[model samples]
Target: MAKRQPRDTLPTHIAQWRDQVRRDYGIEDAPGLILLEQAALALHRAEQARELLAKDGLVTRDRFDQPKPHPAAVIARDAEASFRAALRDLQLDVEPARPVGRPPGV
Candidate 1:
């Protein structure tokens, strides 16, 4: 059997975030990057959890046929909370994403 490569754990958007952080705050240090990584990981986890919830539905039946909330819901909720806290702690003061295409007054 061929040896499987280890999974890449880095967030897909880390580069974009890093660039913004560097441009806006001049933070190119280990601590800042670590915090950013944490935030990104939390967001990734939350997204994955949400996907699972969507696939499984919001509520599911147990072995007893009793309806219960999808377990992924909690994971998504907690991960989202973690992402928010990490962003807050980073203190980058990022602006909200602007609407795409066309200038507002053009």
Candidate 2:
């Protein structure tokens, strides 16, 4: 059997960094807010790429494959939302998602 990769690594890092940054800056929201905003943008770009790939029929799998958002996009959005929610819980302002324009051919 293949060994499973650890799932909690990134979240652990994020939480550790968030705490460190908070302590260093003496501000509750400084770095966490920034990280969340960055993560959100990454997610948006990833989602766009996934849409593009799907439109172009580049990704395929057997019928038994459960449909999922393209991996990168899913990771990005999940990370972004998780961080954003954390920031919100701490009362930080999070930028909303901007609408993406249609692709050139569409």
Each model's TM-score, in the order given? 0.69, 0.34
> Against the hidden true structure, what lDDT does model 2 obtain?
0.56
Candidate 2 is scored at a TM of 0.34
Candidate 1, superposed: residue stretches over 4 Å from native: 1-8, 94-106
lDDT of each: 0.79, 0.56
**Model 2 regions more than 4 Å off:** 1-7, 10-16, 24-60, 64-72, 95-106
lDDT score at residue 21, model 1, on the 0-100 scale? 60
Clashes of 1: 0
- Clashes in model 1: which pairs? none
Best by lDDT: 1
